[model samples]
Target: MEETISLQDLFKTLKKRLALILTCMILGVTIAGVVSYLLMTPTYQSSTQILVNQTQQEQDQFTSQEIQTNLQLINTYNVIIKSPAILDLVIERLTLDMTPGQLTQHITVASEQDSQVVNVTVKDPDPHRAADIANTTAEVFEEEIPKLMNVDNVNILSPAIVGDNPQPVDPNPPLNMAIGAVIGLMIGVGIAFLLEYLDTSIKGERDVEEILDLPILGLISPIPESDVNLDNVVRTRRKRR
Candidate 1:
């Protein structure tokens, strides 16, 4: 016999396994929260801004061509800021124990469209060191760009700083917990449906009829205790006679 389930059966399956589903969700959230907050190392980020402007601007007059040229140069400056030529100097100055390529992994360079400003963001486990790396990279680039391109165009605009208390930017606890909850819910629902699908036991009259593909002729009721005792007594009297 071919067996198929209805919507009512599906709902019943989920409801019957509701406790297991809730347990999975709660367990997922708890584990994610613990890993994010206590087990994983957090990274702090700091950013510094550098301006690429023409050093020899005429007195009180800035030309549109000069502004456009600076805007175009911002992209080149963004690339150079993360290059080994710049990062090597930053490493030497800070005495950081990492190669230029490894240092590049901790730094990001970005520039706004049609703007002459570039932002260098650095992330590290230590907040103060992150700020120091951002500021030093900007300073080293400011000093080196003139020699590299034979133009004094780079200038530090805003330096990164660490306050008395700094916060980590990575391994966000709430976001991790939310993701875990969604994944756990999906797993729980899937498991509930899977268990239901794999079940093959007959549970009631409807299930028996569906499995056997036959109609029930009649129902048998259990005999009462008093009636059974009276029948036994009659049997005993007949036997004695």
Candidate 2:
């Protein structure tokens, strides 16, 4: 026969192992906070925007096809922005020690759907360096695209600038601690249930019935030592009488 657990049993188990669960949660949160604040390196991000638009010859309004063409070209620009053709020049201009591949890892190119503006973002340990890389990448791409595509449509819309006190984008301690707390809670509950399942020793009348599969005819409570001694003295006095 399969045995089923009820809500009472579950609550009892939780109460029995409450201290262990709390200890695990506190430990997990502390570890996460320590790692986020001290051990992990923080990363800062900076971004620059570039616009893609075709030059008109007769000062006429742009047609729908011309605007759509520019939007399509933005995708190609996104790829070129991260390629060695642009990154190599960016590294040389900025005097960065990293290679094109390493620089590529730091760069992200994205544009809104049906929008002509491209956003180039770079992340680094230093906020100023991140801004410099973002701006230099945009400048290099602006200078090199005309030569590569035989068109002068790319324009720097907004350059990246670092503030007096820029904050790092990564290593959020509170979020990490929250996640750690959740994981620790799960682990603690799992351990509690596991220990309950592994325990087979009997503790009370209910356990005795469950183990022996028999009903108790009567309960015999053991007498304390003081009560037994008093009973023996009373029996001796009766015998002397």
Query: Who wins the TM-score comparison?
Result: 2
lDDT of each: 0.89, 0.90
Candidate 1 local Cα displacement, residue 103, angstroms: 0.6
Task: Compute each candidate's TM-score over C-alphas.
Answer: 0.82, 0.86
| Tens-digit lDDT string for candidate 1 (156-213) | 9999989888889998999999999988888899998888778888777787798789
For model 1, what is the alpha-carbon lDDT of residue 108? 94
Q: Output the lDDT of residue 48, model 1.
A: 95
**lDDT per residue as tens, model 2, 111-174:** 9777779999999999999999999999998899889998898899999999988999898899
Would you list the clashing residue pairs of candidate 2? none
Q: Which stretches of candidate 2 lie over 4 Å from their true place?
A: 55-68, 220-241
